[model samples]
Target: MKIAVCGKGGVGKTFFAGSLAGEFVLAGHPVIAIDADSSPNLALTLGLSAEQAKAIVPVAENEELVRLKTGTNYSGVFRLSFTVDDIISRYAVPTPSGASLLVMGTVKAMGSGCACPAHSVVRALMRHLVVERDEVVILDMEAGIEHLGRGTAEHVEILLVVTDANLKSLETAANICRLAQESGIRTIGLVSNRIADDRQEAAVRLFAEQHNLNVIAQLPFDPLVADAGMTGEPLDRSASSAIKAIGELAKKLRGLA
Candidate 1:
């Protein structure tokens, strides 16, 4: 399955994506967790050391922007010389349980008309993974839906949007839903994070109902999650309320316990 997790900044999207991938790995599925966020934190959430994650070099290509001639028949060709396995072997980090992790490093913007080679390469690799890879591929995307708009949306089977229990966060979720609809990507549901009390939970549900969105899961505010983040611990094994909620959400998504 190809799952893409996205939301506004500070919405715990990475946490949800990482935890879901970890759960799948624990359930005996070979999983590939792609940290598509330029400012990535999924590696930390998955309990990977910084040194281990840094081993995988991102797909960096320098391509000249040239229009292809009509009837060139170049659709199946790739510009890169490296195979996916080679790239992964060189750059991917394996967790203790055998799941693989890949990070898409950040790229700086050049002047207008400047090509985005990193974005192109990441998009190509992602497409290959979704179409050819047998393992479950989970992409943890950045806050905005821009990546989805850039043709990656079709590769996603489920688009999970995360949000906090606040009016601004709910508004962002609604906006994301609209963007996803415009991009022709189907949303699986919303996961409300950092709920402080019953009132906040009620607010999240009401917001989802008003927007015609499904509230698939609710995660309470937990200090352990913060500590785990600080310590680079795996959230899947944490006993925190938020982590437990994420595990349940993973089961719901997988149609199993």
Candidate 2:
């Protein structure tokens, strides 16, 4: 059960990703949550201390760049210094509930080019980790699905693009779906976050139907979520409507009522 959650910035992709992973852990599945979003907030949302998260090395930072002669194969030329286990060990932090987290850090303000070794390394490691790892993987991607170019979408079983009620967010969701299609990602769906009431719910449903996208879940605008973030606490799954809906969505994805 591998899943990738993406959305427009500020639409709650990381929160949904973290909550989904936590719910799976609660349900007794060993899960590996990948923070593929360059913004990097899954750890905080999951209530992990900065020290614990920082101990996990970023994949790109840990990669070794090799300069290959003009004609060398790209894959053969670049070398990864760390073993998969080592990379996992250095980057995955286990929660008390048993879910692990790996942070895929941002490319250093440098544009996307082979010259950016860190980005290249991170991209390569992400491909390997997602495809080879045993545990159920959940990737929390940035708004644009940039990870698609790095082959992260290849291993994903479902790509959930989250959006809010606004027009801009809806447009972004459409764009993400288009990009995912271009990148060969399949099984795309939508999650409408911060839904206010029945009116907003209808709007999202209509939007999804019009766009021919599935609305797997609609999360209510909850102050508790913001409170949890502000206080550096994990969302209380039992009490949060949004979290509960996300959990149910996860179960639906897994076919595990």
Candidate 3:
């Protein structure tokens, strides 16, 4: 299953993405968790130590690696076609929960008309993983999935836009849904996060029903998740309302594919 989890900032999308990766691995799939967020903390969410996360260099910031892949000597022409197969074994750090993590870092443009080698490497590696590779891939995307362009978006199986009871968050999810649909990513679902009570759950479900979007999951407001984050530990799956809900959501996603 190739899924992209996206949502507005502070909506707990990262937590959901981490849970999804954990669920996939628990199901016996060798998963690749992509930390595409500019400010990444998936390592902590995946139960990796701070030093281990820091050890996995963000591909965008690796100038030497980018130079090697893209041929920095030339201005106009660069190597776009290369193998990133070894990249997984060489760079990916394994989490305690049995998922390989690759921190993509932030891919930002220098200026207009600039041939960003880092961006090139990111795109190439992403294509390799999403299109060429066979493992389960989960991309914890930023508010906007700017890196996974139309070409890349088409190959992805689903884009799960996470939100809460807030109207603005749902609005952002709607906008992201439109963007993904435009890119030919048809299997888009809404994951409602942090519903404190049944009232909030009903409101979120009503909004999702009105929008004609599938409600993949509705996660409760569990303080344990926050505590886990604070402790820099992976969320405990047992009795975790959010994790249980996400496991069901993963089952639903598997059916979709």
Per-candidate Cα RMSD to the true structure, in Å, reads 5.5, 4.4, 2.2
lDDT value for model 2? 0.74
lDDT leader:
3
Winning candidate number (TM-score):
3
Candidate 2 on 1-257: residue-level lDDT in tens? Answer: 77888888888888888888888888878888888777687886676777776666665555432132112366445444433445567557776546788777774322455545466556656766677777788888877776545456656667889999888898889888887777677678889999988888888888888887778777899888888778877667688888878878877887831
For each candidate, give its TM-score against the true structure: 0.80, 0.84, 0.92
As for lDDT, the candidate ahead, 2 or 3, is 3
Find the 10 residues in a row with the least total lDDT in model 1: 62-71
Error of 1 at 46 (Å): 1.2
Better of 1 and 2 by TM-score: 2
lDDT of 1 by residue, 1-257 (tens): 78878788887888778878887887788898888787776776777777865654554422222111111246644344333444556557777646688876653322234244455455556667766677888888876556543455665667778999878988988887776776666546788998888999999999898999988788888888887677766544656787678778777777721
With a 3 Å backbone cut-off (N, CA, C), the pairs that clash in candidate 2 are none
